[model samples]
Target: MLLKKSPSNPIQAASMGINKTEDQAISGWERLRFLYEQPSMERDLSRRIINMAFLTGFFFGGVATSAQARETFERSNIGQRFLSASDVLKRQADYAIVRFAKSGFPMGFKCALVSGSIVYADFLKIFHCG
Candidate 1:
């Protein structure tokens, strides 16, 4: 004959929903603490931390090296093409401005840098050049 298994403690029964009201009364932090106390949870947390640290270091190192490489490239002749292009554009713009002035039309021009910002701060407007 097999004996029927039974709860060995009152709180065990209360925790098992035999006392649904008591279980519902447990705070969210208390529930999280209970789940976090498991060995499986501890192992998972440690693994996640290690993975995150590795990824962060890899990305940070990549960005630092790329920045240095970009600076070096910008100093080379090929990279100086950007400045030559800008000068050509300015010449064309100046020619257009002279033509527009001779035409005497109500035309206006603003030659702002590509990497500049227009900012409004406390009733003051400022144009920042890159």
Candidate 2:
């Protein structure tokens, strides 16, 4: 009985296939070394431009929502006069801007506006600073 021909005794074939991939590791390392040695200024600049555009859009959208929220909050005058969906959405959008900007901040007005439900928390402050 030839153990090599037996499917149940295929341990040697499995180990040989694994060693074949390991043998090509040198070629993979050489290819990586070639790329690593080349200049990447163009890639770097393109990456920077893409990053800036993304960040600008993010902050600009946040600021726009904040402004709209401010208008809604002011119209309500501390939300005592009216409480429409637009007003609520405006305040929420503005609060989201503040929350996104002041990440890792506590849930209060001293550090940032109190966002979320009023029943669980206190009043919401719509005030902003220059």
Candidate 3:
């Protein structure tokens, strides 16, 4: 039986996702060389533009939400203090915003208010700055 010769190029081996210790032993230096030799993957122009637009939209949306939240909080005449969601709910408040902003997330949260003062903030566990 004649066994076919395996590939000697590191780039070919890595790109194929072949397992290591399989007769073809690729050294670290070879892998780095392969990475340097390979050209970057080309993407379609429209796809790239769409991705950029999506990212920009997401970023601007977050900024807008934060600004809206800050304005709402300030206008309520409540001290610039934020409390936990559960804590806010437990406190005595005449009305609640029901829709508020938490740091670093694109979702809305509920805030309890008492006489225009923020009592507590209930938000998702995704992310929060403070």
Candidate 4:
């Protein structure tokens, strides 16, 4: 024997149009069809492209700045000496001494070295450089 299901609520049954077929229900792709049919689709697409380009440029700009900083640090006098130092000394050394002039005072800077190059430096103290 087969059983026929009946609507539990009269209002819901009327709103749902009991005669409507299952095929009339909206599907996932059909719901998104309105986006493609929109008049401002081209404007939205152009905005998305511009946003992506700006993000890409910002990311690469940061990378380039980091590389430039590393290069500048490596070209300094203290950086040159640090790179030429023996591996054992490089491992033990964590500070660099800097002198601004021939008779100038010396300054010590705490530094982090990586791949035989200075990656970071922070001022530690001013001291005699005799």
Worst 10 residues of 2 by lDDT: 116-125
Q: What tens-digit string does per-residue lDDT give for candidate 4 at 25-60?
A: 333333234324444443355445545554555454
Candidate 4: TM-score? 0.27
What is the per-residue lDDT of model 3 for residues 1-130, given as tens digits with 9 covering 90 to 100?
Answer: 9985656764475556654454665554554344446553321332344455545554554565655664565577566455786654444231222232133223211111111121112211112235
Q: Put down candidate 2 lDDT per residue, 1-130, tens digits, no spaces.
A: 6564422322222223333233333232333233234444433443455455555555654555566656655665663643687976676666667745653222222222212111111111122123
Write down the RMSD of all candidates, one decimal each: 22.5, 20.3, 17.8, 24.1
Which segments of model 4 are wrong by more than 4 Å?
1-39, 73-130
Better of 1 and 4 by lDDT: 1
TM-score of each: 0.27, 0.30, 0.26, 0.27
RMSD of 4: 24.1
How many clashing residue pairs are found in candidate 1?
0
lDDT for position 13 in model 1: 39
lDDT of each: 0.40, 0.41, 0.41, 0.35
Q: Deviation in angstroms for 115 in model 4?
A: 38
Candidate 1 global CA lDDT score: 0.40
Please list the residue runs of candidate 2 whose C-alpha ends up more than 4 Å from where it truly belongs after superposition.
Answer: 1-39, 74-130
Ranking by TM-score: 2, 1, 4, 3
- Runs off by more than 4 Å, candidate 3: 1-4, 22-57, 60-130
Weakest ten-residue segment in model 3 by summed lDDT: 110-119
Reference-based lDDT, residue 51, model 1? 53
**What is the alpha-carbon lDDT for the whole of candidate 2?**
0.41
